[model samples]
Target: MASERDYFHLSGPLHLTHVKWDNLYHRKSVAASLVQGVYVQEKDRQEQRKGPNALAFPWWAFFHFQLLHTLVDDVDNSIFGAIYEFKPPPSKCNDTLHKTPRYVIAFRGTIKKPDSISRDIELDLQFIRNGLHQTSRSNIAIEAVRNMVASVGGSNLWLAGHSLGSCMTLLAGKDMAKNGILIESFLFNPPYASAPIERIRSKKLKHRLRIASSVVKAGLAIAMKDKKSSSFDSLSAWIPCLFVNPSDYICSEYVGYFEHRRKMEEIGAGSIEKVATQNSVISLMMSAFGKESEPLHLIPSATLAVNFTPSRNFKEAHGIHQWWKPDLCLQSKLYKY
Candidate 1:
């Protein structure tokens, strides 16, 4: 039988052990690895019945972090997220290179397996309906994050997740930001519920459609001024790091989401763009039906990082494994509200 280490493709003797603590790439790699660890933990649980000592920590050794807690889905009893406490070597304890977070809460995305697929897909659908926060899994994750923040404070705590898990992180981070607790967060391939306008082939047609959509959304915002409010404005300063691939339609819209805002500014429609970006059409429709929903994709600020490197397929493009790779062609820009 293959060992758990064989399952981890990125972490081993050849992994990023030499990278300093303050290296941005290293931090990204560590966050991705920790999230992957949650996947391995779940796999261990599934296989534990086969033999003794089946549980494993595949990525822990490479990053010098210990699993402090695992956030399990109450319905399926499967692991979804984990809290890792950094355990640097004694030799490097006094070095200023220890600027990294003392604790990190990383969430894993959907795992397509018989043991966890149902719950994962259910949460994915809830994500589409903007009802993910109402699930018990979300409640558990938010409580875990909140307790961690209260235990150690937010200054040295970090939140990270990929895909559906990224949605959880965004919601949790937003909740914390709303209460004046700003924690560093990294979101990879987070799904945007809006249409995939970025997939359109014609640049001119795409631009025109975006402009029309923005105008309509802006008009609706003005017409519903009394009913709607900019609750996200307070989160303007808490910018999470968003990692996206242009080839991945689930997340690629974010590339245009931020870019379109800039174009709106260039055309002197900054005020319209502000209102339109804060409120999505789905949220407006829900309000019409007397249903309150918060669009999980909308955010006031983010440090958007787009991968320019061409991917082989959607799976390769959307995989969390790519974020930990050292030689990635990426373009990063900070969009501030």
Candidate 2:
């Protein structure tokens, strides 16, 4: 809280600039990757949409499965960036909102290295799927987030993610809230979107874009100067869509829906339900993976629980051309949601 830079999760501990692991699942080889998969993002892009009545309804934008987190003294004239090639649609945002919420996004269903933060794993498919060893993983990601919130001068926060990332995020949100962190969360295309029974994926459908950069100078001219309305006081999320058909989502991919969809719904809706179902096709496969038995009539709720998107429906639509590509260079606006 001393300085903006001081408000980071781990300043010195950023040591894991490169993470090391192994292909233990296959051959006896080792691997190196960025810690926390901070460099890896799902899908998204940036577009210039300067509104006359308004300009920054959706301050930023991203792809379907990419991950992005930002903190700013001025939510106006925002700097938007992604970690990958594809850029997601910016259709999940509100133009003139009642409150400004903390934005969080994660990829769903897609499994990451055991560290959950490592993203550059190029081993065999089965090898990488083993949930390989991940070093320097954070048990409490919200702590890193909490650090961010503190730096932003806010007590309330918004959380969101897709697939596996979404599940993990909700779990962290629960931990943060239980630990007395005033925060709200959103799950975009998360695998699980149920409370009692697991579902295929979120049903919320929609798109969100990033349009803060180009029009920031003229856009936030009015919104930013508003002393009464502030970002810190109104931290909430409006991403994630429910699986119109939860029965199609997979267990591992649908983790967030199970851990936090209900709670997220209590705070946010619309995108929190359907969009996730639309992003990934794996949910449908997972929906068909398990069998219907007696006591455990549903799928296992232990390791990698949560529904997934079906192949026939929500397939891997990641690309600058597709509506779900995650873009970081910030110069793409040709796709539609």
- Which is the leading candidate under lDDT? 1
TM-score, candidate number 2: 0.32
Tens digit of per-residue lDDT, candidate 2, span 113-223: 233213322211212232111212223344556565665533334444433444444444544543445454433333332222333233332111111111232233233
lDDT of 1 by residue, 1-337 (tens): 4453436543433467565667667777778878777777787777663344443475765667898989989999999999999887866564545578989999989987789999999999998888898999999999999999999999989999999989999989999998999999999999999899999999898889888888888787677762434467878878999999999999999999999999989989888888888777877777668787888889979999998888999998998878877788988999997
Off by over 4 Å in 1: 1-6, 9-13, 49-56, 94-96, 226-228
TM-score for all models, in order of appearance = 0.94, 0.32
Q: What lDDT does each candidate get?
A: 0.84, 0.27
Q: How far is 151's C-alpha from truth in model 2 (Å)?
A: 2.9
The global Cα lDDT (0 to 1) of model 2 is 0.27
